[model samples]
Target chain A: MTNAPEITGETDIAPPVSSTGIVAWMRERLFSSPLNIIMTVLCGLLVIATLPPFIEWALIKAVWISPTADACRAARGGACWAFIAEKHRLILFGLYPYDEQWRPLLAALVNIALIVASCMRRFWNIRLLYIWGIGLVLISWLMWGGVLGLSYVENTKWGGLPLTLILATFGVGFAFPFGIVLALGRRSNMPAIKTLCIMYIELIRGVPLISLLFMSSVMLPLFFPEGFSIDKLLRAQIAIIMFAAAYIAEVVRGGLQAIPKGQYEAADALGLSYWKKTGLIILPQALKIVIPPMVSLFIAMFKDTSLVVIIGIFDLMNATKASLTDTAWKGFAVESYIFVSIIYFVFCFSMSKYSQQLEARLATGHKR
Target chain B: MKKVKATAFAVLAMVAAGSVGMAASPALAGATFDAVKARGILQCGVNTALGGFSAPDSKGEWQGIDVDVCRAVAAAMFGDASKVRFSPLTSQARLTALQSGEIDMLSRNTTLTLQRDAAIGLNPTGVTFYDGQGFLVPKKLNVKSAKELGGATVCVQSGSTTELNLADYFRAQKMEFKPVVFEKLEELVAAFFAGRCDVYTSDASQLASGRALQAPNPDDYVILPEIISKEPLGPFVRHGDDQWHDVVRWSLFAMIEAEEYGITSKNVDEMLKSNDPNVKRILGVTPGMGKALGLDDKWAYNIIKLVGNYGESYERNVGSGSKLNLPRGYNAQWSKGGLLYAWPIR
Candidate 1:
């Protein structure tokens, strides 16, 4: 009765200021305990010590444009972005004939378009396969131009970003199906097929990709009869495909294992053939589960394409290294590396983000 | 047990047959030359990137002393310098590329060595550039002589002859030094410039180029006036192809001889009419030299005309005209107190 007597329409007082808003958030999150306070202060000190100098070096004092390296050297401690400006073509198109650089630029754009289209769920059909087929053929024609009005440019002359994209795209395109086959073989009841798949996967996975590239570039030629040679780029491509297939097989196998036995039984009870069951039921679900890992592998493979530099294939990383070989721009390696790292990050980061979105989109069925 | 024995026998037979097949094809002297002619392009392996030695220019045209040697060979073979395809190869891949015929020849700044010449199925065509290992040190060290440094940290590339020479020189001088090694030239150079090491050792020409180009301030570092470890960098062809070897060897010689005769690319046509018998012989007016090498009568003339002489290549690539700006010391002609003495063209 005494409490009820005080029923006035007064607004409730705000929670203690320290327990709400950004100030409260800071207190609760950053200064809740001595350990947290110490960590926050240490992090703040680290940022203070590093950020300004980095900003000054990378942006404020950096030379964005210069006619020659001397102008960059004049800026001294700051980044020489002019080196990248002068060498961008050499880094992007590589030793491809300078006048014909447009071909590679177009080819790269086409490949990027195909990748974008493939990412879209609406294009997930036989039509996408046709698009990829046509896109690859066009890329090959553009790169090794013996047909049409395009003059012949040897694969040896193909390099830089276009080369990197070709290697990665073709590597994944070929390896995905091959990997699925390997995964199925590994899971087969036939001992011989299973053994062979296991051996291949284990053997390929056992060695580093560098060794595989070396074998293809160096040792494979020795085994061939003199004067009978495969194209160096082709050989390198095969090595990458084989190497990627091994890793992808394991990833697909993980996805296959995650599928419930009931799903398999359900397909079987529906009186579906093995191929039909795999293609319609098992594969769709298994591939959906593996999208995240598959994208991760793709990103890994995209970066790993840089390893072709060891075999002297002028991939993006190799071309960047080659560009630094210019005596005039030699000391600006840091800027060049950062530039290429950003290119790689853009590609990898997008793939990761797309994979997350895809996971969410495909995960709607499982939601409560 | 019987099956194992049979398998072993079959493997032995196959290996034997393979060896016999290989031996039968040994000394196919004109094989490479014919292949080059048939292909209409010389697949020349050059350094992936070595600045003054072999590296692509801004226009994506390869420009270097090593590249010139390959171009000269192509000019001699096809009567056109542009008929050359450059395969930029890493140091580890160069010898294999040559031995396996992945390249028609390797003009990749490879040093002439007994193991390479005799054991690796490659024959050194000729010395294209005379290089020597030397030390580069920051001037602030105030070190006048390499011998004066008793204890200094040295940055060198691993898996190079320079590394061995560094260890040997230090041990011979009875000086104690710590070695900081890197697998990449960029990292090694960066480390040296960052003061991680007191000395950076490489080919003297490379040091000059590195100082001139890579240094934040070229004046801050000095190449010591001591040259150790002879590096007779040269072009190489597979060993079984003697005709190809001869063509490559004489192509280099033609450049040197052309330099000796003062036959510049600009004056090559004018010099063709000269009455000098040696000039006539070299320029292929004599005809026998070309026939001996299994090339057209105008082979040497094509080389001199299209690719320029050795001295011109030197100046254009690594001398005063280039960023390297290295002095022509040991690389100069024999008459000029240097080691480049071409065998007589006749």
Candidate 2:
């Protein structure tokens, strides 16, 4: 902090900050270097050009509710939000009988709760493992039920935001442990094991999500004998888990590589087994360092959840599309897409923001 | 912090101003067909592949009931059905493409409804085929009727009338069933075949088309006798141009009327010379109908000659003579006890 006494007669002391004036300090921080000035001006112009039109179309001029298309149709433009009004429940709940949508809604709450708990720095331990396990079982039970006099809702009827959350959460949740195993195997002294893991990860990472979905939606049945049919949603979920695991394995491998040789040597000196050393010493520090990328992986998986719509899963994107068929809200496609985009952007942005916070917090313990 | 707030506020202000500008323009007016003709090509949207309805053959030649309507319109305008360029659209993409003027006409076996015509600014010409949602189940399920398939998982295409109609029908029948909805028609068919769902539900014609491909045995699946909802499928034009609507609508009506008069594409040229006043007027031997629609003297004759009449297109694509072997049920002409009764072209 700069300390200076008030100068009654001398001009040595700095002036106090004025509310309206463009201070030297503000200018130095915001537009100090040429690059800073350029970036600021460019970003400012970009925001100016894009933001207002989006906000105006999406919110200010958007019709929140209307009985019919004609009601929303004026000489002037208005979003015929009546499509959403009529089909919102269908999109949110899919074929899940309307009366039973509360089950999926509650399951979605569990995902939110688990996400909130996982983000707290203090809860980042063994308790998280418990939370994830319990959360998954509870959510699954609620979504696909045969209990408590609640009529069972088949997996095919599972959809909307809950379906998206389930796919992403379970995909990343199951993939994390599988990824660690695969990453370790890739770096193993046993050549056969290393080659196997390498092949699995490379093959999956090389293909697009659509092809994987096709294989799951089309090829999986051929692989399973006749008369043995797995639920379509389960098949998609399995494909996503396997696909995410391969990418997560690569991310985990990068984290594994960044660990100093001394940590392994220290564990070896203490006569620690490979599993013991990895679980206690290596994984903790490595995961801490790679936390940002891991969060990014989760976000990618979340976005990838939408592609399941191609295979016929009524995830949020599919739901939005289904609503468009309502005819009364046919022309309001732009409004509906913008709404879907906002839903996606909010989730992605918050995850990124949390990743930034975690990266800053974890940086205190590690140099690299 | 202040700068961020200022930028956000500025953006909101701009969007509000832009929206006000958009409001000044009129909505729900269709002017696309004239625009397409002015652009010198008819943009006719069809399906990527649905064998007898709309699909390309081995030679990359597009054929089918829906494709013929598109071609007939093209032949009427440019005097060659071959002049029309086909834009293959998925179900999700079809309506948006039409609304956005990406395609001038949508002749993709799309069902017509008051909501679709009014909401999308499309003027549905007339029902070309009367269809209804039906269920296709494997023989082993032993489902004798749609009612027997209660509590069964039924695969249905998403964003379709089939989805809502399935719910409405099952509820009315007091039947309990689970719907496994897919967005793509192809995927839904595949899923149904794979036993992802016990029953495949769609337009009866589509059910036949899909059932033809299922494995184990061709005869293993059976389409139930029940018809769930009325699917009055037809061709459509954008809303604004009443002139263009008349052209398309009359083209379809002339084809049906010609068939009712026992006129085939092979005999259309001869029929043009007939003493029958109604036939002569429709063939454009009379000037008023052709002149009023801004069409050539032989527009109806050209459509019939190039694309054939309605019956010819049907029999060639999906009727008893075709691979699909769909019976001429509700799609038969009005004189043949079907619901298809075209308004007199005169």
Candidate 3:
């Protein structure tokens, strides 16, 4: 190789750093091509028209606290955040016993902790599943008492932020596995089992949540034997789980379909049982591929949780509305609405961003 | 107070709302009146369903206390009580619709509040019915007083004063309770009966009305006697339009004034030719007062002749003659120690 040839020119080491500055970035991405320039201008105008007033209303001029409605003065050109500050507790806690609220708070923390633990790549194992089970049991035990010398509280009295968290956590936690089983069953060669699963998924997906909740609340009682009644929260929870399962099944089915036929043949070549092959070979890759869609589903479920307010379970939105009905804060609806909207937007936007990140990570592994 | 709007499209019938009469745009307040007159109908807002308050009868004709208020206003404006179009609104949508100028006036069973007047930019003309919030629990619960049920779950409409009252009542009793809320009264009531909630709380009259609609047996539930909060139901007009407010306010006052003056719809014409100065002044025999309000002197006469007096409207809608069969407890005439007092027409 002639000793790697002689050294190159002076410019070889640093070809050209192309001016690293805002102006350079602006020129390259925003003004380099005609299409890019047009898109930038369009986006700029959209931001100007939308973002400034929103920022002004939501942050810059918003009153963080006010003793009376006069302090808001809607004409004064600012949001009345004080209304939310005053009633936020009521909106978040609903009818939970005041002193016992610590239980729900602790429960919420545990649930959040479990979710965080599961998200860490280092802890992504079957043991992580126990976190959820333990967390749910601890939460219910903490909230419902009747053990450990704590006073027992009924589920019906559960409302506010705690109720909302419980519904969403339990809803997705139980729904995921159920959805996977349903998807597998639907795709199975067994015609009877497939038909039953297909019918179930379709029927649940066909109706609105309101009707399902109504059926659970009203028609469910009629179906059960006399004196064997389900609690309102349980009825609503079951309806939510069933509703979520149908959607999740469809998503999971897509993931399963994306697995190549060669993988199945390779698993068969290993002489593995059907369950063992599918569980060890197919599920791991399929679930990884479907992470983005699953996250999006979670965000959607969060929004749908608001509908529970309509049926009398005082979720976050319901509690906000309930707090506004106070004669002391009668005209502070705009403030209250904005606060809850912020809460919803923050959670949903973060989830969507996380989903995007997961999609990018997953994309790196799949060259095709 | 039950304030059903009778004339939804009827404002156009008697008013000569020509192209040049006024602006036809909805953005302007008075312009809507011109539009209604041009369209030859009054756009009236009423309740969709509330027994005896503003519900349709067997033949589908709207009847109730609120309906007669609309009819009275329509009769005053158009000289024809039946020349109205009824638009029903849920409680949540009522204020927004009126604020947006979707309807001329809201004659639903809307409560009068200072917040509605100063904050929401709507004017309360007068109280039509004096109601109070109360609780209704199923008989199986065996709860006689609301105070006894400390931890009970209550079903209440999402956006009403009743919700606040429920919280305050329970809190004052040092009892903690959960509330299941719905945006619609019908849905809330249905949920209550379906056993989703332990108690149903609302305006006492509404509790009675909801109970009546329940099948199987209405007697399975009982409305508690504790009156929690004062709910002075009334008609509302949009703010910034003093003339329209005056018209709506006086139209309601005219009914009470007519009842006080013993002027019945059956003999309003005979009273028009009477020698009594009060009757003649109210009947427009003395026309100068109408000039001040920018209306014809015959406005009160048109109101009485078209829609009956206060007592007559109540009896026809919510009292003994109607399905609601609600007694005229606090809605009776001022002479009978009730609150239906009216200022002088002249």
Residue-level lDDT tens digits of model 2 in B261-323:
777899988887899888888788876777777878788888888888989988988886675
lDDT digits (tens) for residues A39-131 of candidate 1:
999999999999999999999989988888888887767999888889999999899999999999999999999999999989999999999
Q: TM-scores of the models, in the given order?
A: 0.93, 0.53, 0.52
Q: Which pairs of residues have clashing backbones in candidate 1?
A: none
> lDDT score, residue A9, model 1?
68
Q: Every model's DockQ, to 2 decimals?
A: 0.45, 0.02, 0.02
- The best-first sequence of candidates by TM-score reads 1, 2, 3
Q: Is the docking of candidate 3 incorrect, acceptable, medium or high quality?
A: incorrect
CA lDDT, every model vs. true structure: 0.87, 0.75, 0.74
Name the weakest run of 10 consecutive residues (lDDT summed) in model 2 chain B.
B19-28
Please tell me which model should have the higher DockQ, number 1 or number 3: 1
Q: Rank the candidates by lDDT, best first.
A: 1, 2, 3
RMSD of 1: 4.4
> How many residue pairs clash (N, CA or C atoms closer than 3 angstroms) in each of the candidate models, in the order given?
0, 6, 22
Q: Residue A326 in candidate 1 has what lDDT? A: 81
